[model samples]
Target: MHAAVVHSFDELPRYDTIDVPVARTPDEVVVDVLAAGLHPRVRSGADGTHYTSEGTLPMVPGVDGVGRTPDGGLVYFVASDDAPGTMAARALVDRRRSITLPVDTDPVAVAAAMNPGMSSWVALRRRVGFQPGGSVLVLGATGNAGQLAVQIARHLGASRVIGAGRDAQHLELVDALGADEVVSLDGDDAGDRLGRAAGDVDVVVDYLWGRPTEQAMKAVLMARTDRSRPLAWVQVGSMAGPEIALPSFLLRAANLSVLGSGQGSVTTAGIVAELPALAALVASGVLTVDALAVPLADVEHAWTRPVRPGQRLVLVP
Candidate 1:
């Protein structure tokens, strides 16, 4: 079998022949890889930067993917934190960790959307306890995950979805993806604009943390018309930066709750529980994402290419 093998954490994965994965436990099942996404987490794992990185050498470097079993059952699976992952001709996955998909589902799109899509889906459904017809503001709404967040929020019964991003064009694009309003983060008064737009928002799904997050927090604080109204701030990703100096007044002055989602914060079963519904949405065309499917042999080149906003690069094995 061939796979994207990582010999050293410092170097890029080399696509070449490697030993096939063997199931060591009774609960594990081996599935032929169809398409795997090059998510930022996967890249971080390859670079030994993700918290889950095991510091093991000579291993495959994918966290999740869509694949088919020997009996022709289609499934999406998440790899164990320490095991060789999904960027290969085959992967060994725990049966409990895999979700069966419809036969007609597009494997490439599912592979591309699941990880990024899960960031917000799990946060809204589990962590923040999203209410039906509630208003949502997505802070980094131009990114792939943010775009999906807008759509998922709408699908989950958000009455108003505000998409906020630095890219004007991408913000416009998110409007088509179910965002009721779009806010640009380019101007000096962007925070003020965000405050006004978020005045009545019930939940905020934040993908970018740092200056944008700080601005959003200030905006929320400034726009609070009713201090009694509850607001849940769910932090999913930090593409902007890792740290922020949050004012203590923001928490004290309003009914605001800050929570982080993903990995250790959300249980593995909790994340996997939402996949079936999400996969159904994607398969039924209620949710969609722009994906480029490249051959596994082209992993090196595809990995280095600059990803456009809202676009995902999927490796087809």
Candidate 2:
């Protein structure tokens, strides 16, 4: 069987041959890999940077993907951390962690949208007690997950959705995706603009969490019409930097709560519970994702390619 093998953390995964995966438990089944996404999480795992990395070598690098079972049923499966990932021609999938998809589902689209979309989906649905008619502000709104957050927030019944990011061109696309307002996270007045536009938002789905987040947090705190109003800041991804210099007064002065949403914060069962609905939404075309399908043989090239904003790369075996 052919698979993407990572012999070292320093080098890119190579297209190589590996033994076929065998299911070891009754709960697990080997499925034919239809499509797998080249998500940032997968990249981090491959490079041994993710918090969940086990420091294992000669590994495959995929978190979740769409596959076909032996009975010809289509499904979306999440790969176990210790097992070979879904980047191979065939991957071992735990049926308990998988969801059955419609026969007409597009594997590439589901593979492309699920992981990134889940970041915002899980954050909004599980991380906070979000209600309909509340306003939301996405900090890094031009990226793939951020763009989806803008739409997802609106679909989940947000009265107002504000998208703030640095890309001028992609920010326009974010607006088209259903953001009620767009603010540029650039220039000297970036914080001022974000504060003015999103100070009153009920929730914030933040993906950038470094200086940008620090500046935005203080700006929002200082500009809120009523500091007593509850504000939930759900930190999803740390795209800019890992740490922020949070001041004690910021937390003490307002009704602000900052919490992270990820593997540890949200349980595996919790994430899987929401997958069926999210997959249905993506499959039904209610939620849109721009995906570029690349052959598995070109994994090396695809891995090295610069990621374009708002576009996802899906590997087809």
Candidate 3:
């Protein structure tokens, strides 16, 4: 079998021939990889920067993908931590960890949208118990995942959705994607603009966690009309930076609760349980994303290519 092999943590993966993976458990079976997403999480694993990286060598790097089972059924599978990934001609998949997809499902679309789209879906549905009629603010609305977050928030019944990001060009498109308002985090008045637009939002899906998160957090907290109202800040990604200098008073003064939604925070079963519904939305065109599909042989080139805002890369085998 051939795969995108990560030989070194400092470099990009190369297209190389590797041994086919074998199922080790009764519930596990080998599936032919159809399409796999080149997501930021996969990049982190390939570069050995993710928290879960074990510094293993000559490894395949993919978290989830669409594949074909032995009986000619299509499925979307999540790779387990201890097994080889889905960026290959064939991958080991656990039956319990996968969901059967409709025969007519588009493999490329599912592979491209699932992982990124799942972040916000699982966060609101499982992590925070977000209710209908609530308002949401997406902190990094320009990125691929953030763009999906904007749409997902509205689809999940958000009364009003506000998108705030550093890119002016992407911010312009958020309104069309269902955001009630958009704020640009580009100039000197970015903090003020964010506060005024999103201060009273019921939920915040924050992807930028560095200086932007710090400034935005303070701005929203200070501008809230009712400080005692509960505000759920769900941290999904750290596109800007990892750490932030958080003021203690912000937590004490307002009803602000900061939590994370990701692999460790949410159970694998919980994440998988939400996938069928999210995948259905993606298939029905309710939750859509711009995808660039490339052949698996060109994994190296696609890895280096610059992806446009709100676009994702899918590697097809």
Candidate 4:
């Protein structure tokens, strides 16, 4: 079968003939992949520069995808640890890793929305005790995952959702997705701009890292009217760059709790178990997918697009 493969780090991705392995155990499931999600980590790992890089080559570019099996074909998986990505015509997944969805479930919706969708979901539901009326600040809130962060925050019952991004238009789009307020990070005085935009923020869900990460942290620090209540900061992505140098004073003074929300860092078993609940949310329209569809043959080129303003691409095989 044809599968999208990254031949080498820094080289463009390409398709190759891959022999799909047979299920060696009863627990294993074989699938015909229909769609795949392009994540930033997939590109970084493909380029051999990501933190989790093992210098692997000829890797399938997608980590999460929508797929179906031959029997019944009703259930599918969204993420895989050792399972094949959806960029392939045929893939083998651990049946346990797959999440059953409506056969009519929009794979693009699942693909475009799932990873980031799950990140924000996990952030609020697991990391922080996100209250019904609390405020949320999403830094880098327009990237594929970042946009999902804002949406999921709203679905999780955050009273006010604040989005921060590089472009004004992107922030506007995020606002449309239920962000009560949006902040633009690409500015001469981004700190001041963000400080001005923040409104009664109780929880800060941070996906921006490096300078923006520090800058957003400072913005949260400056916007705090109440100093005693803990402001939860959920760090999901580091697309701006991953070196975080947080001042100790923010945590000390505000009693702030900053969390690391790595999608894969958590056990795969936990994610698999949670997928059913998440799938139900998707089926009910609580979760929405904003995606651009790309042909699987063009996987290499699609991975190169810049992330911003609903740049999530779903590979249709």
Every model's TM-score: 0.97, 0.99, 0.99, 0.91
* RMSD of candidate 2 to true structure, Å: 0.8
Q: Which ten residues in a row have the lowest lDDT in candidate 3?
A: 167-176
Native-to-model Cα distance after best TM-score fit, residue 47 in candidate 4, in Å: 1.7
lDDT score of residue 179 within candidate 2: 94
The candidate 2 region of ten consecutive residues with least summed lDDT is 78-87
lDDT per residue, candidate 1, 216-293, as tens digits? 888877798897799998889889998899889888888999999989998888888888998888778888788999
TM-score computed on alpha carbons, candidate 2: 0.99
RMSD after Cα superposition, model 1: 1.1
**Per-candidate local distance difference test:** 0.90, 0.93, 0.92, 0.74
Query: How many residue-pair clashes does candidate 4 contain?
Result: 3
What is the Å distance of residue 127 in model 2 from its true position?
0.7
Clashes of each: 0, 0, 0, 3
- Candidate 3, residues 105-159: lDDT per residue as tens digits? 9999999999999999999999899999999999999888898999999999999
Q: What's the lDDT for residue 261 in model 2? A: 94
